[model samples]
Target: MPTPAPSASTPPPAPPATGAAPPGLPPGPPRTPPAPPSRARRLAAPVATLAGVAAAFAYVGTVDPNEPGHYPVCPLLRFTGILCPGCGGLRSAHAFARGDLVTALGCNALAVAGYAVFAVVMAVWLVRAVRGTPSRVTVRPVWWWVLGAVLALFTIVRNLPVGSALAP
Candidate 1:
């Protein structure tokens, strides 16, 4: 027998996409979106993270890394006499906390750049957290490789006489 076709005035609505089951199967529960987190819940992590960072800076500011006995010498510097990317990070942080931007950059320009990037990211994260949106950091693999290459270059150049300015 031939089936009769309906007149094409209005299109058919899509069937409800939930709660249907195969002939022998039981129906499953309906789908729902999870509720967004509460304001305090959303803010907690960003706030705590900022507080911890602030505390660290405060401690670094109080304790001078220039005083040899206060901080440990970089193992790479001590053993191999090679300056790593993070050779003067603590001293940089100490200078930064004391509001000596020039000295901070002089101590470790890369670390100072990192501090600026961290500040910008944390500010954005705090704003997003307050607005009840989750903050996510997504870097492409290519960018990661580029960053690694940049670091390697920094490490290499800092050790060379031509890049003595970059050395800590």
Candidate 2:
């Protein structure tokens, strides 16, 4: 293979060769750092998330999950007669929101952990937003797979008689 030739450094590439440079240092205004969010954009996502969480909490809070008609039953429970890891999560959240820790744990321990994790993540998000920094979340693919496997195993084990404590 042939090597590329180096160019002369004496003269920098001409802008167009036809137009003259403007009166001051250059034509354009002095480059400024990017502006932070305006009032509306800054509050939008957080407000929406808060509203959604409030709505979810309200729905779960008012409606009893034990009743058949009030909430959609989990298909796994209905058809397979087995409890999934997500089972009783609504009841758990309702109990949690109502300040009943024992009931919440009886419902689903993992769901409580999820709520705490979500709170932490949202706190980070809010801090970043206030600081005018971009909010970002990055998880490795391996972590994703591991999380999936863990949830699957938890679901399977929770349904078994041997792991009755894990059951909702």
Candidate 3:
């Protein structure tokens, strides 16, 4: 039997071609690109980080860590009679802020290295922030393990009688 044609009152349906865009959408890219941040927004993170670092250094520079009660003793040093990796970090920062590199290294060589690393990283971050680019620091697992091992070795050596110079 022959099928009846659709009445004129009914509209024709859209074709189901795979390449065709969905109804009401433009034919090119589907999404609008996000707007970039304002200049102040881009600079905020780096500036805040630098300000916090400066405040910390200022506090450390003013405080005398060599005095017995200025800062709390390292828990590992006080309780376990062992020097931890961060045993003299405050003293290191204090000496570093005072421009005494030798004393800073003597207080904590690792902490001095950390200060250098922080400086380099923050410089990069500031540049990127000014340019409105995203930046990150990524340390792989193996490097993290190596860092831990190095800290452990430092702690052990600093606690020994022969390495008394390394102790703060």
Candidate 4:
């Protein structure tokens, strides 16, 4: 049997229209996008980090690391009588604060290199932060292993008589 047609009392569905609300529906409120951060707000984090680092450096600069009692000896060096990669990091920082690059390198060349890398990275971070696009330093596992290996080699060589200059 054929199906029956709709009754005359019923209304047909309206056709959809472009850029218009559907029939019987109320229009919603207009959207307002969120505002971007201000320049000072964008720079706050980087500035705080730099301030903390500067404070630490100032403390290290005032302290005399060359004095025997001023800083604790590296536990690894004390126990094994061998130089570790960080054996003279404090001295390096102290010398670096005093503007003695030669002494800082003599203390811990790797640490000095690390400081330079940190400075460059921080500079980039600050620039990006000011532009409201902060970034991160992402070292892959392989690079992390390479860094560890380099530090290990530095430690081993520094302990050897031939690499005495590397010792601190």
Candidate 5:
């Protein structure tokens, strides 16, 4: 005797009921939208951002902003007797370009830290760019407040006679 083939008459399974909402609230908009980004735009934005950063670094590296008259004076330094955290940033970058790490740090340790952070971020950005991945950067409000407090403290300490070492 020969075996028979199975029938193809099986019915499709029913989908679970997911349309109902909680009783207390009215129906609301969808939590997420259906539309998705195009591949070209997704790749273009990261590439543009990376290129912009490279251009900025290149400009800074080429132009000797440390020169007395090369760059415009800071408005804060012009009007106020106090120095801002960014006052020596240009000089610091210049020192960095010249491979003088100590002078760069002395000019603006905060700027040096920022440079290092930016370099690391750019490295990750380039990797993501090549891998065709999306990038997202988010900082908590508490972190922003903490950063502000730290800058304020740095500003105060740099001005004190005892903290002259912190000054540029």
Candidate 6:
């Protein structure tokens, strides 16, 4: 027996075509990767960062942290009577800004190392920006743990009489 045809009130259903856009949505233009930033634009961040750091060092160099009432006392040292890893960071920066490496190291060896690292990283960043190449420094989780351990050790040692040399 032949099947009955649909009445005029109902139309025949159509199947969806393969790889076609959803129902009524229009196809979008071809996607393209964004263009790299201009050399000046890339350089802007590093230069601004350097400028800010320089300003901070300048301010620190001008105001002596060694004097009483210049900068706020470290709450850790004030309340807990413990020297944190950053206890003499300002003094170290001040000495570093004044080109006195020995004094900077004497104030805070760890902080002096940090300043050196910052200088090196900024130099690398500026160089890459000038060359129109992008650079990223990805530190691993292990390094962070190591850094934390080192800071803890530094704090402990600096508070000991034997580590008086490390004290501020």
Span of ten consecutive residues with least summed lDDT in model 1 = 13-22
Model 2 per-residue lDDT tens digits across residues 1-168 = 985565685565546323444656455544556787775687678768978998998888888776768888889899989888899898898898888988898889889888888999888877777666788799999999988998999888887788788777
Q: State which candidate, 1 or 3, has the greater TM-score.
A: 1
2 or 5, greater by TM-score: 2
Off by over 4 Å in 5: 1-43
**What local distance difference test score does each model get?**
0.90, 0.81, 0.88, 0.87, 0.78, 0.92
| Residue-by-residue lDDT tens digits, candidate 1, 1-168 | 996676698577656557666668876666777888899998899899999999999999999999879988999999999999998899999999999999899889999999999999999998998887767999999999998998999999999999998876
Q: Which scores better on TM-score, 1 or 5?
A: 1
lDDT of 4 by residue, 19-56 (tens): 44657887555445679889898888888888998998
Worst 10 residues of 4 by lDDT: 13-22
List candidate 3 stretches off by more than 4 Å: 1-31
Residue lDDT tens for model 6, 52-123: 998999999999999999899999999999999999899999999899999999999999999879989999
Ten-residue region with minimum lDDT total, candidate 2 = 12-21
Worst 10 residues of 3 by lDDT: 25-34
Put down candidate 3 lDDT per residue, 1-168, tens digits, no spaces: 997797999888755555557789755434556799988998898889899999999999999898889888888788888888898899999999999999999889999999998899989988888888888888999999999999888888888999888888
Clashes of 5: 0
Give per-residue lDDT, candidate 4, residue 111: 94
Of the candidates numbered 4 and 6, which has the greater lDDT value?
A: 6
**Which candidate gets the maximum lDDT versus the true structure?**
6
On a 0 to 100 scale, what is the lDDT of residue 135 in model 5? 73
Output the worst ten-in-a-row residue range by lDDT, candidate 5.
12-21
- Candidates sorted on TM-score, descending: 6, 1, 3, 4, 2, 5
Each candidate: how many clashes?
A: 0, 0, 0, 0, 0, 0
